[model samples]
Structures are given as structure tokens and as C-alpha cells.
Target: MEYEAATRHFAALGHPGRLSVVRLLLRHAPRGVRPTEIAGTLGMKSNTLSHHLAELEGAGLIGSAREGRSLFYTVRLPELAALIAYLGQDCGRGRPDLMPTHPTEIDMDRPFNVLFICSGNSARSIFAEAILRSLGGTRFRAFSAGTRPNSVLNPFAIEVLERNGLDTSGLRSKHVAEFEGPEAPRMDFVFTVCDQAASDECAPWPGQPLTAHWGMPDPAKAEGTDAEKGLAFAKAFGELHRRISAFTQLPFDQLERLALQQHLDRLGEA
Candidate 1:
């Protein structure tokens, strides 16, 4: 980062309002928030929020994307990281404690709680919960939920899990709200397993959990004979299994938050 560029970034965040905006955006990283929601959450007038957003974007501290009719804003993590690095460039000279450490380094002794989400809790998300439950052993606790959940679990999904020797007795469809309340478990990670759910406006999860989109084809929408539908569900199961297996094998204690997030986004592509 050039000194000039660093100065620009600092200038953008110099205002109290702008700094608050940046903090809120960081909490919702990887999931862009719409301008209306930002305004509502921060109690800022639309005109004022727009000015701040423009300034942040001009400084490359934030970025936006058009999703359908809405423009969503997200913090540019790499740029922010560069600014932090520029500030702390010489921290190791004498202040070893001032050097940054990975968040997971302090939490490695406890099991991580992971939540998988989808449009319907019936299929893909459920498959993920089961796969992680079986593969993660005591190192991870997996949960699943939906944005608009069906009343019952998808039969084909259950069939596929049973065929693969996974327990299905306790699995059922659940709303995302179930996990959003004050009483809900704090999640270490949250993943969206379908494109529709990924694009939906989700409530800000408690704990500001690390999130990623891991979209897969919806097997519940699969049309064919029972055998073919079962195959579709089985394929979904395999894909989630592969992803979760890779996730469990990650070196959490060694990777920083940003690096861990990058690995998660890459797994979605895989």
C-alpha cells in the first residue's frame, strides 16, 4: 500500500459515522447488506448514508454489487487488511504482543458450532448437518435451518442418508429464526448451501460467525422416478460430504480469520 493510498483510506474512516458503518459491514462480511438496511440499522438518513458509502467506495474501503434490483454493499477485506498492515508494519521491532493473532488460536480447545442454511431445511442443509455430525466427531457441532422451511423433511433426503448409514431419526425441518434468538447457540461458522438462501437477506447471526456460500443443486426439486430422485439426493449428499470433510481437516490454529474465510469461499467453488 502506498502512503498516499493509506492516507486516503484513513481519511475515509476518520468520521465516527463512517467508522460505525465499517464496523457493521465487517460484522456482515461475505454477505452484502442493502443500503436501506444499513440506514435503518444505523439510524442514518438515506442522503447521509449515501455520502458515506460513496466516500468509502472511493477510498476502496468498500465495494458493491447489483443483485437483482438492489445494490448491496460489502467491506473490501483485503484493502482493510492492507491498511492494518501499513499501520502495524513495524510492530515486531519491540512490541511482540502488539502483533496480531488468529481468533481461532484462543478457541481451539473448544468444539466449533457450525450452522448450514438453505431455502428449505429439507435437503441440502440437512445433508450437511448429518455429514458434519458423522465426520467431525466431537470437534464440531453441526446444525441446519432454512429461510422458508418446509413443514417436513424431504423423503428422498432421508432415504439417501439412510442408504449411506447416517442417523436420520432426529433430523427435521427448522426455520432460520430458531437459531437467531438470544437463547440460540452461538455459531462459530455459518454456511448457505443453496443459491436462493445465499441471496436472501438473512438476519445478522449472533456472534458475527464466519460465513460462506456453498450452493449446491436442490434435490427436492429433482423430477423423475423414485430411483432417479434418490440418486439426485445422494449426489447432493456426496458434494456436501466432500466439502465438510475438507472443512474438518483445516488447520484452524494456524490460519488467520481472513485466510480461513478465503479457504471457505474456495471450498464452495470446489
Candidate 2:
């Protein structure tokens, strides 16, 4: 992701104040600028400057290192250099034939991969994955697996999905181990539907994904007549669909990690 993603950098720099602040930081260079000094020089309120700094930091164009009790902010020159090299790589050292006449483009809609984990890949977690896929297919790739899968989806879960016009053709249960290795896709978010005690059963994934616990009563564990079990799956499906709908509306790229994590936690509670 060049420049914390070129689109993000451009977005963060689009504001006049942020642009000016970046230029100021650039002047300070390798030594860095203290937060107080930046606010004083820019004549910006501390809260306003903090907002700009968070945006810049999230875009990867800037970094901070602690100095005493204060944090010093500075441009990430190496990242900037890498972005320059990436843009120039296509120029073929001034080869007219290879160089693009127009500016480079970035696909800002790149999907963020999400994984849902549960004790059994049967009901709640599976429902979450399917709900997110159907609701946020434009911006998310959703997956689900269990610590110890039973090798079959709960028949009721499939029925609920199909009833809502969601595909269920290849919705077989899988072990979480399948996605723990190097070959697995890099996940941006990991939602654990199992409680804390049972969560330990699934091995930690390779990528340090942003994770949260969105536990719900496991619908598959309902011991009742067919109608009662169906009702349970339906409730889980409705709840997951509501959460996914709300999640997809978030300004995902604009949010810093901590803010994004907080939103995810709150979404589960709602």
C-alpha cells in the first residue's frame, strides 16, 4: 500500500490546513516537529491539529516517535521515496514508449477481507459471513470457519440464507486451521462469535487482523422443535444482517485503527 495508499494520502492532504501542516513538517525534516510546536506555528487549535495529525498518520505519510512526554511527528521519507519509485518504474528511465502520459490511478474500492470465527462453523458465525457478503459485497470479502468444524452447514442456516436470496451452494463448514497458514488471504477484520473461553480453541491467524468479539447465543445449540430452531437461526440472521448493514456504511478508509476498533465493538453491542 503506497503512501498508506496514495488515495488516502491525497485525501488527507486535500484540506488546506492539513496540506499546510504537511509542508511545515517537511521543512522540519529528519529531526521532526513537536505537537506543541506544530500547533503554535500553524496557529491551529490543539483539537483541530490533532484531527489533522490523526488523518495524516492514518494515511502513512507521517509517523510519530516519543520524545519525553511529547510525541514528535515527521514525514515518512522512505515511504514517499517508495511511492516515487513506483510511479517512475513504469517510465522505463525516460522511455517515451513506456511512460504514461496521464497521472497514475488508484482503485480506492479495494475490498477489505473479513473472517468470522466460531466453535462450530454451523450457525451464528456462518450467518455473519453470509450476511456481510450479501450486504457489503462491494467493499468486503467475508469468510467463516470454526475451531472444529462438523464438515456440514446447519441445514437451517442454509435455508435461512436461501430464503433471503443469499447463495449457499458451497457453504461447507471448514476448520480455522485452513486460513492460519501463509497461503491464506490477509484479513483486515476478524470477528470471533465464540465466547472468550472457547475462543482459545482457534489458533491465532498469521496476519495481525483487527479483531473483536461479537458473541451471540449459538443458534445451533437450540434444543427444541423444528419451528423453534428455525426461529433461533432467523433471529441470528436478522441481527447479523443489521450489523453488516450498519458496518458497510462506515467511512472505513477515513477512520484510524483505534476509532475503527471502537466502532466495531459498539456495532456488536447494538
Candidate 3:
């Protein structure tokens, strides 16, 4: 594949939600996942999961078939193999010693570690963490924590995520203090997804990561029928998806720290 084609493929796999789907398929390998199971597992709605599944299928990373009322999907192993081989198509052809390297030791797929903070960790922050991680893929590692975490995820959040067929397994609300100690991972970016978390003065941030406030409306606060709540969650996910897609496409190496920060500010506004 050409570089552009490869980049697009990588970009397609960038979202944390999409990556979750890809990982699931890869884990299952020869046996594909069915649409209903995917939806039920992720707490997503059937229609929304279909959209994400279609995107994966379009990227040539997955294949699907219909069995009665259900649709099954499988990871296309050969397609993944071809993509890997294309990355090294010209290896050692000229200066084998001159292969491009990352500016830092961290994997490009695992660009700056990200942490999303909020008060409850029940809705918006969880959405941000999952969507950003799935959408950003390995380009960034995303996590969520609350100043005072809830015991369980919001049911609506679970509903929407499952509808989109994202992996909701092993997810739990966490206290922000867990990330404040000396042993915490160095965060490249720290975002507060709610006003309270943004304005909190007691947070003991260690590394002074680039901090930003993204005041996303609470999905839990959404008042409506189940369908309405799902729509709100979907809207929030789409907004984050768009902003993040733009941010990830920028040439970070060419931008100064201040410029990059400014760009991120604009992204938050988006």
C-alpha cells in the first residue's frame, strides 16, 4: 500500500472505540462476532453499532455476513498481514540504516498519555476516555478518573457505548488521587470534562501535564426517554470524535509547545 493509503488505514484504526472493535475481532480471529452480541456486549444500540461496523468494513480490516436476522463479522487476517508487509516494502533497498524513527521513544500510536477527569466519572468523562482511546487508538493512551468516583458507570453511557459496539468490559470509575502520587504515569495531557473538576483547587497534579477544561454537558443530566439519552450520548461522542480526528492529523513535530497548546484549546472549543 502507498503511504497515504497506509496512513488512512492507521487513521481509521485510531479511534479507541474502533480500536476496541478491531481488537475484539482480532481476539476472535477466524470466528467473527455477530451484530447483536457486539451490541449487547458494548451496551450499544443496533443501528449505531451498524455505523461503526460499516466504517471498519469499509477500511478493509473486517468482513461481514448475514445469518438469518443477525450479521457476523470477522477480522481479515490476510488484509492485516498485507498492511504490515506494505510498511516494509522497501526495507534495506537503499540505506537500510536510514529508516525513519520517532522523535521520542514512545510509540507514535501511543502518543502522549492522556487522562480525563471529572467529578462523578459516571458520564462525560467516561465517554471522553472511551471514545478518545478507541478513536485515537495507540496514537494516544486515554484514561478516566473522578475527584470522587461513582461505584458504577451511568446506565445511559453503557447503553450508548454498547449501541456503538465498543468494549465496556473492565471499565470502572476511579479516584483522581490515584494519579497524584509519585508513582503515577507521566501524563502528557490532563483534561477535566466538567466544570467542577476543572475548577477544583485540591487536585495534586504531579508532572504539570498540559491541562485543559472541556466542559462537556453531562449525559446523565440529559432528561428524556431512552432514545433521547442515546441520541445525546451519540452527539457527544461525535463531537469528540471530530475534534480528536482533527487534532491527531496535525503535524505535532513542527509546532511549538505554545502553538500546540493553542491548537488544543481550539480543539476543546470544537
Alpha-carbon lDDT of model 3: 0.71
The number of the candidate with the highest TM-score is 1
Clashes of each: 0, 0, 20
Instruction: For candidate 3, report its TM-score.
Output: 0.56
Worst 10 residues of 2 by lDDT: 99-108
> Candidate 3 on 1-270: residue-level lDDT in tens?
666667767877887777767765653444556777666656678887788888888888889988788778987877776676665554444354544332232234446788888888877778778777677766787888887754568887888777877778867888887777778887877877765565444454555566556666766777879888888878877776676678667776677665666677677666
Regions of candidate 1 where Cα sits further than 4 Å from its true position: 1-106
Which regions of candidate 3 fall more than 4 Å away from where they truly are?
A: 1-110
Instruction: Write one digit per residue (lDDT tens) for candidate 2, span 1-270.
Output: 444476677788789989877877654444466788788767899999999999999888899999788888988877766555555663246466554342132124678889988878888778888888878867889999887745578899999999999977667788888788888897778887755213244455555566766767788888789999999899989988888788889887687676776688788667
What does candidate 1's lDDT look like per residue over 1-270, in tens digits? 788998899999999889988977775566677899788878899999999999999999999999899999999988998888776764344354665544453278789999999988998999999999999999999999998955578888888899899999799999999999889999999998986676566777766678888877898888989888888888899999999999999998889887888899889877
Could you tell me the lDDT of residue 17 within candidate 3?
70
* Model 2 lDDT, full chain set: 0.75
Residue pairs with clashing backbones, model 1: none
* Candidate number achieving the greatest lDDT relative to the actual structure: 1
TM-score of each: 0.67, 0.58, 0.56
Candidate 3 local Cα displacement, residue 218, angstroms:
1.0
lDDT scores of the candidates, listed in order: 0.86, 0.75, 0.71
Instruction: Score residue 99 of candidate 1 by CA lDDT.
Output: 54
